[model samples]
Target: IMLVSVTERTREIGIRLAIGALEREVLLQFLIEAMVLSSFGGLVGIALATAASLALAHAMQLPYLFNLQINLVAFFFSAALGVIFGYFPARRAARLNPIEALRHE
Candidate 1:
């Protein structure tokens, strides 16, 4: 996904690098984008799970258990995974030759 994003934005990345944007800055930008995407997905997943869990619990006459700590941990884990997985593509983008990227259609 990250790679595809990088590929899609090749011209933008090229322009940024050409305009003297630091490689680290470009890398961080991609990483932050990935984190945001993952966090949003995680939040949605949590909400859906909670709703289903609640419905099932109610049907079974059981108490719905909501654990904040567990949710927080899962959220953080997902964000971390995003960063870890995104690093490679971010690095690739950062290392791109400005001239080559700019030539990309």
Candidate 2:
């Protein structure tokens, strides 16, 4: 269900590109939006996970890695994910034929 949604959205982006939009522009637009949304969602998940982990640790009396912090690795992972995920859609958009794409609906 989710994959279908993403693909359909990507196709719309491709149509935009077919009309002379730059590949990077389309990619960046989607990537930025996705990152913004994902960041908010990830933060919420992180907070919940942190609280749950703390409670679990206390209950189970287990050792914990208490110094958890975001780092360069996390940044890189996020960027890489954005680029990697965005690349194919951007490429498809770039390859569109304006006439054919305009005919798609």
RMSD of each: 0.6, 3.7
* TM-score, cand. 2: 0.60
Please name the candidate that would achieve the greatest TM-score relative to the true structure.
1
The ten-residue window of minimal lDDT in model 2 covers 1-10
Angstrom error of the Cα, residue 24, model 2: value is 2.5
TM-score of 1: 0.98
Off by over 4 Å in 2: 1-6, 10-15, 18-20, 61-65, 70-72
Tens-digit lDDT track for model 2 on 2-30?
23434566557656776678866765666
TM-score of each candidate structure, all chains considered together: 0.98, 0.60
lDDT per residue (tens digit) for residues 46-92 in model 1: 89989999999999999999999999988998899899999999999
- Evaluated against the true structure, the overall lDDT of model 1 is 0.95
lDDT scores for all predictions? 0.95, 0.60
